[model samples]
Target: MAARETTNARTLTIALAQYAQLELSDPSAFDHFCQSVRSICEASARDGKKIDLLAFPEMHLFGTGTAGEDEANQAQLDAAVDIPQSNGGETEFIADSLPARCAELAKELGIWLIPGTFCERNPEGGIYNTAAVFSPSGELSGSYRKICPWRPYERYTPGDSFTVIDIPGKGRLGLTVCYDAWFPELSRQVAWLGADIIVNLVRTTTPDRRQELVLARATAITNQVFVASVNAAAPQGVGQSLLVDPEGEILHDSEGSDEELLIDTIDLDAVSRVRRIGTAGSNRLWEQFRPDDPEIPLPLYEGHIKPLRWQPQQH
Candidate 1:
C-alpha cells in the first residue's frame, strides 16, 4: 500500500467491494466470489490507482436473504467456513482457514483486505459472526465479532469486545459488523479508543436502510472520524455503500441498489486535525465526563423488555 499524500495529512485509498449478495450453495460459489475480488484488484492495478484498503460487506456468503439460521440449511451453513482454532495470527492466516485465504488474496493483490463477516466456530462449540481484516503483509490485522446480531433469532453468539487495528501507512481502523452501527455506544467506544476510521460491514435490506445511512453519517460527525460504512449490493440489499469524511460529508454514496464498488481516497489525518482544533474529541462530552464521577441513575431506557404476544416479521 502506497502512501497517498495530502495537504498536511496522510491519505488512504479505500476500495469498497460492494459485492453482489451471494448464496454460497457450495464451496465453488465461494471460490467464484474470490475470483471476482481478484478481477477488481487487477483492474485497479491496470488503472495505476492500487488500493490500500479493500473492504467487502457483511455475511457476504449467505447472500443476506435468509430469514434466519432456523430457516437456513444447517449443513450448508457449516460448510461455508473453515474456522481453524490454531490458525489465526497477527501476521499469518492458518492453512485452509478463511482468514488464511483472505490474507493470501490480499498479499497476492498487494492490498489490505477486509473480507467481511464469516461464521466462526468458537472454542465453546458455538459459532460467531466474525469479521477479519487482512494486511498486505498476509497477516490478519483485526478480528471482531458482531456484538449485536440482527434482532432476535440470530444464530451466532454475540461478541464481548471491539478492536482497532493500526494499519501501517494508513491509520487505526476500528472494526464492527452489522447491527452494531445502530448503537451509538459502539462507535463512540471505538472513537474514544483511538480509531481514525470506523469500518463497519453491513448487509442491510430495504425499509431500514434509510436509518442506516443516517446513523453512518451521524457517527462520523459525532466522532470526527472517517466512516467506511459498506453494505451488500444485490437484490437482497439496498446498496448505499457510503464513505463519509470526518465532517460528516458524504464523500462517496452509491445511488444505485446494485453492485457499486466505492473506490475513493480519504485523508486519515483529518481526524486528528479536527480533534486538535477542539471540534471533535476535545469538545465532546466524553472529554468533560469521567467514568468515576457520579451521575443520576435515570435510565434513558428505563423499562424491562419482554416479548409481546405477537412477534414482528422481517426480523
Candidate 2:
C-alpha cells in the first residue's frame, strides 16, 4: 500500500446509517443494498458536505429477514467469507469477496467506509464475527475480529487481539464489534494504542441495548476519546445508534428503532484538550499517576499495569 499524505486537520465528519434489515434472498438483493448505500453517499455529496467516514451497524451483511433462527444461522455461516490477516501490515483481500465490494465502494465514493461486520470462516476452524475497515483510496486498511462473542448463544471463535487504524489526514480509529464494548479492558487497550475515536458496530435485539448505551458514554468519558456506536434498527435490532464526544456528551443519537442517518463533524483535538486540562477541568484521570507510582497487579489477566504505561499515546 502506498503511504497516504498527512494533513494537520483535526476535525472529521462521519455518517452513521442505522439500517433496518430486510429479507435478502439472493446476490441481487445484496447489490440493491450496496446501491442504497451509494445513494446515501451521493446525497451527502450533493448537499455539499462530503462525509469522511460512513459506517453501518454490525451484521449488516448477514440480514436474513423472516428466516428462522436455525435458517438465519445457517445462511450466515454459508455466506461467511475469508478475510486476510494483516499481521501488523497491509492486507490484500480476495477479489470476489464482500470486503472487495466494500473497498470498491469506498474508492468510488472517495470516503472512508465501514460497511459493518460479516460472519467469517476461520481457516483454523470455527466462525468469527469480524469488522473490516476501508480507506478512501480503496485500501483494505485493517480488520478486527470480536474478542468477546456473546457467550452460550453465539457459537463463534473469539479473536485474541484489538485493531486500530490510522486514517492519514483524519485520525486514528479503533474498531470494535457489538459485545466487545461490554469489556472495558478492550476499549482501554484500544485507547492506549492511540485511537482518537472508537467505532463500535452493533446488532443488538435484546433489552440489554439500554445498558449498552450507558457503556458507550462511559467508554468515551473514561477513555477521553470520541465514540461512535452504530446499531441496527428494529425489528432487526434496537436502534439507538449514537455518537459521544470526548466529554461523553451525545453529539447525535437516533433514540428510537427507526432507520435514520446520524451525521456529525467532531473536533478530534478535543481528545487532547480533555486529557491535558481534564474532563470538566476536574478529573484528569490520564494524568493521575505520579512518577513513582507502583504497578498495580491484575490477577485476572495475570499481568501488571505499570504506571508509566498507563498514559494514552499522544497525538
Candidate 3:
C-alpha cells in the first residue's frame, strides 16, 4: 500500500474490480473468495495503480437469494459460520463478523476497501441486507443497511438509519445497497450530511439495468460527491459495474460477461470544486425543490382537454 497523496478532492483515483463467481451456500468457499480479492488488490499495487480506494461488488462472499428466504437452501446458507467471536461468542456477533473480516483485509492491504453488501442477522434473529466498511487501519469504520428493500427483500428487515463512515485519507463516505440506488433521496441525504463519496454496493440479475446506472451518475452529479459503484460480474449476478466521479463521469467500468479488474484513478478535488461552486453543479438544488413545495404544483390543463382516444361507446 502507498501513502496517501494530496490531490484534488474532485479527482479521486479509484480502483474497481468486478468479481464473477460466488457460492453463498458453501461456507468453505469464503476463504477462496477472500484470496481472490486479495490477489486483485496485490496485483493493482504491483501495477503501480495509485488506488486511493479499492471496491468489490455486492455479495462476493456469499451468493444471493440464499439467505433469509423460505426456500430449502436457506438452511445451507445459514450454516456457513461467519466466525463468531472465538471465546464466549460475546465479543463477535455473527452479523458483525463479515465487516470485521473486511477490516482485517483492509489493514493488510493498507487501502480503503468497499466490501460489498452481505447477509446479516439482527439481534432478534431477523435478517438484514447490509454493507460494511473498513478503514486502512483494519478498523471497522461503519456499516449501512439497505433502507429501501426491493420485492422479496421485504423478508429482510430494512435498516433504520443512515450512516456515513469517515476514513483518514478519504472524507466521509456514504453506503447504499443495490435497489437503494434507484431512489435519489438516499444519496441526497448522504450528501446533505457532507459526504465526499458514496459506495453503492449492489447485485442485479442482468446488465439491462443501465437506466439505474444512469441514475447513479445523476446521484453523483446532483449530490456533488464521488460515487463508486461496485457490482458483481457474470455467473453470479449482473456485471456492467462502474465507478462514477462527482462530475458524473464514468471513471471505470467493467463489461457484463467476465471477471476482471476495472481500476482507475480519481482526483478527489473535483468534489470540492464542484461543491463549492454550488450551482446546478452542487446538489444544493435538490433541497430547493421541496417535496411539498406549493409553488411547484402538478401540471394541470386550464381548459378541458380531450382524450387521445375515446373509450368505447357505452350502451
Clashing residue pair totals per candidate (backbone < 3 A): 0, 0, 21
**Model 2 CA deviation exceeding 4 Å by range:** 1-9, 22-24, 87-91
lDDT of 1 by residue, 189-257 (tens): 788677889999988876788999999999988887889888988776778889998778888999878
Candidate 1: lDDT of 226?
88
Q: Which candidate number would show the highest TM-score if scored against the true structure? A: 2
lDDT of 3 by residue, 233-314 (tens): 7766677778777768777777664777777766555566555455344344433444343443324534322232111111
TM-score of 1: 0.83
Query: Local error of candidate 1 at 245, Å?
Result: 0.7
* Top lDDT model: 2
